[model samples]
Target: MDNQKPSSGGTFKKFIIALVAIVILALGITGVVYYLRWFGPNVTDKQEYLYIHSEAGFNDVYQTIREQGIVKDTTTFLWAAHNMNYVGRVKPGKYRLKEGMSNRKLINMLASGAQEPVDLKFRGLRLKTQFAGYISKQIEPDSVAIISLLDSAKFVEQYGFTTENVYTMFMPNTYQMYWNTTSEQFFKRMYKEYENFWTPARKQLAAAINLTPIQVSILASVVDAEALHDDEMPTIAGLYLNRLKRGIKMEADPTVIFATGDFTIKRVLNKYLSTPSPYNTYRNTGLPPGPIMMPSVNAVKAVLNYKQHNYIYMCAKEDFSGYHNFATNVAEHMANAHRFQQALNERGIKK
Candidate 1:
């Protein structure tokens, strides 16, 4: 029953202790909240990939991230991004979205421009427009953008190619590139690959054949179109080389097909041959202004190492085995052509 009043200093010390405890508790709660917001799993389970387009601003990125519903929480991500100074550092690219990604990791990845590389592959493309369309699907630039660069004489000229011969610069192969590659960058990359492909040996082989690299591509395109089987590429190449040597027109059916712009033609009629296009090897001598299609590597090689042969005429084998019947004389070629025509007539492949 003895109660003594405490001193003012003791009461002040008690208040101070309580204040310190409250401050510590508040700090701990704040730290925990921030940790959960910034370091906790943010990505949803539904998305496996996220694509950010070129020149995307922070608002655009946030809109996409939220609209995709991959990020489990958006407000927290925005806060984290702001604190990390990532608001202005949005990098456009393709990114893999994981099932469980933290805001910090995602923000860091985007801010640092860590984009996935796309595997761009093209082969046997018929036209420059076709090439542009194929490339548009693999990267950031659209078909129109690619076509603009492909059609630009000035732009392609810097790469030592006219617009007509620019098709040769793009070799058929798989190339690894950033998804956000510009059209100009894509062309430069292709040009570099083209240079790499045409080594000193390949150049010497082209020289030996009295053909420029582009001319080789042109001839290879014809060879590729002529032979359905790879085994016969060298033979077809040799036949064309023989024709060139003899000053005879190539009279290639594929060139007629190219001239008519009718890929569905199973048989090239006399009318088709007289289409009067520059690509018509029947009417024009030497290589066409450009390749009719993107020639394969094997086709180009076939032209470089053409088979030695005296046969200058070839017709598709009547057996339909994708083999050709070779002839050293016009009479024999006519017989072969007659047999092939009979076979085609039996198959009902008119026109």
Candidate 2:
């Protein structure tokens, strides 16, 4: 065989090819690692709402995330958060985590403060305690936090409300607000909403009725509680207005039930009516100091535009149809009351 010297050029070319291949492989592997750290699915299936408290620092948020096991790999998430500049910017909110969300997307959501809103709807909440408890479940602040403002005479006075009448500020509606809203912020927001609700026209209507906006709301609460059907609110409101003009006691059984602090009472008894409270309209000659419950819009409007009539007394229909029978005298009212009482007895609704 003829001996040929191995060409140096050929040998160099093979070496070059191997080196390039190795370099390309190394680069590909690095790219994959980077992708895993930055763009890969990091959120775990344990996806639940993450409530970042108001004014929470980065550490507190990170600790919450870590403790909750929100990410598949904590180390990778930490690296991604730092690299994406999400470490320093921590926003408080109610965040919902989706399964298989990339690390970058997760960091972006938290850093950008893109939070979910809570739906706060209040209707027939009879007590401040009930209202506070309802609010606490939707927001970060506890019930105690809300009650402190509701009961603070000085705080409520600044908003043109007394501690006893602060409930009038919040009417029945679905309010959209952030979960991180502080208690003070909630009160301010409700006051703003209240102000918006009482427009100049509505205020004029309230003035024409010989009542302030708050007094109207207080009367509306009684109307709201007494009338199960919205259509009857106007007639019921007129009856109460007649009583107001005649210097007669309201004798609102709902007010008496509210005064007793027992919402479970299906029928108001004499004992319950005798409960000692400023809210008890039975002994009182006018509307209670505050709203018995958060008034509905219909009820509030009913008071403002109450039908002109001589109906000074009203009673629930004995048929349990949630309607009330109107009367102009105590005799007719007592007859209506007797029938309702018999119905209540038949139904065994004794309190």
Candidate 3:
């Protein structure tokens, strides 16, 4: 009976040891799993940004993460993502990935749809298509999609703009926006900006000048295209306004270049003057149908406060300086034109 008690006690001790060992092993495994799920650094130092597309699922996101070489362990990230319910909730945006970010932080940010906004700056765009192209480079919508909206007369008319003058609605400036902004959203945002730009004070100025807002924009575009120097814009605007007041043809060379669809024509030739388009200010009696190019805010303001001058004509200086020689009579303008023509001939810039 004593030997039987001893054997039973030994067996109980062995069972206790086995139970303790199993508990320790389980705790070790749980610690490792916990570290991987929430604490371990998943992002690598080499990674800078992560772009999650709108249609991306778990596999697509995983592939992108792997391709960027940011995650430390793909399997651990997958496990954490699956557990955190971040597998199917992929958000589309430009994400700034920081080094040493844990799976928990990364997954939480992505799941919450916290994406960085893109700074979109558009300047010097001449056509609506060009504006669309510029916007498409920064946003989710493609060029074709944006162009569809820009060209749709029915859609643009809702914003009180025609297909021809629709380009004026998008003022050129930097905007902070999300990357997934739709084309319609972008247009509305720009229209809002356009409205904000034409404040009551600006509207009063336009009324005082006897020009509508769009007309002011058109004239500003002409002035912008004509003057290479910003300081000379007011003078150029004054000359055009004088012509407008006298009921004379604006006879702007940029309009002819726009009509000809040839931006490379540095020297406006007589052949370009005969173009039959309404945009040909030499042939047309007043302003063109719309702006030839996107005008700057300074250019628009210059038109609002034009310089008061009696000079009725202008010709490019013969010295190749981007300055113009102003004239009150046809004889003086002819002299300036002859000098410029001679300079162009000397430089072999015919046609």
Candidate 4:
């Protein structure tokens, strides 16, 4: 056995080796911590969306995330957010929280302001309030904001519309837009779509028919209201147009129902015709000041391409097939009306 006292130099060398090993271990652990903070999967399985309003701050966003538990290991996410400087760059949007997304990717997306879009859709809106309410549900603004914008005479004038007629500017369609769209922005987009729809050819057709775009929309709403089946729209539209050309009162029962504010009125009685409202076509000589409802594209086209006929009157068909009976004279119309009244009486649909 060659036993000898260990030299001081040898002892120091061992100590140095141990120190290097410790340093390497520490570096390995630190690397893992950093990687977990930045690159680890932070979005939880609870996969939901994150909706930040137009004017939200980081605190509001964080509070929502924290309260909703939208993420996993928020501790590491917070650290990464601070380190990556995402706290100062909060973007308002609808963010889809994808599963297995790392903190770095989420932070980058937020910082870069890349947000998902929303599909906004509406149809058969009978009133301006209904339109506003339906639109508000999918966007950041409230119904009050939409109603205020629609009611503002000055604001609507730029779009070549009056407060009463501005409702016609919005065509029923599925519009892909941002969730944070402001009310003004929504109106601007709708106006753009409206312009796109009313092309030069349609404009010429409207002019040839002696009706403005707003008037066409008004008539389309009435046509849509009277015809439950789309196939009957053209004939119904022609009948109303003929009535208009002949200077005949529309006597639209739908308008009477609208004026009464009783949407449940199954039968437009004589008393309901007396309802005092500008919307009551039974009293008004021409198209009402605004549309009774948001008109469909089909109904609108039906007005533009109305079937040429001598029909000046119409009533719902007696068979309840959602079709109408057309007439060129009041005697025929009265007979049709009597049949419809008899049907109504048999069905007990009295208001």
* Top candidate, metric TM-score: 4
Question: Order of all candidates by TM-score, from best down to worst?
Answer: 4, 2, 1, 3
Cα lDDT tens digits, model 1, 182-222, are 99899899999999999999999999989999999999999
Off by over 4 Å in 3: 1-26, 45-47, 67-70
Better of 1 and 2 by lDDT: 1
In terms of lDDT, model 3 sits at 0.90
Mind giving the per-residue lDDT tens digits that candidate 4 earns over 142-244?
9999999999999999999999989889899999999899999999999999999999999999999899999999999999999898888999888888889
Model 4, residue 14: distance off in Å is 4.8
lDDT of 3 at 65: 87
Which pairs of residues have clashing backbones in candidate 1?
none
Scored against the true structure, residue 143 in model 3 reaches a CA lDDT of: 96
Native-to-model Cα distance after best TM-score fit, residue 130 in candidate 1, in Å: 1.3
- What digit string (tens of lDDT, one per residue) describes model 3 on residues 1-351? 445445788999999999999999999999998987788888998767787777778799899888879798988898889999997788878788999899999998888889899999987788778887878889989999999987899999999888787777777789999988888898889999999999999999989889989899999999999998899999999999999999999999999999999998998888889999989999999899899999998899999989999988999899988999999999999999999999999999887
Every candidate's lDDT? 0.92, 0.90, 0.90, 0.90
Clashing pairs in model 2, backbone N/Cα/C closer than 3 A: none
The TM-score between candidate 3 and the true structure equals 0.90
Indicate the residue-level lDDT of 219 in model 2.
98
Candidate 4 ranges with C-alpha deviation above 4 Å: 1-17
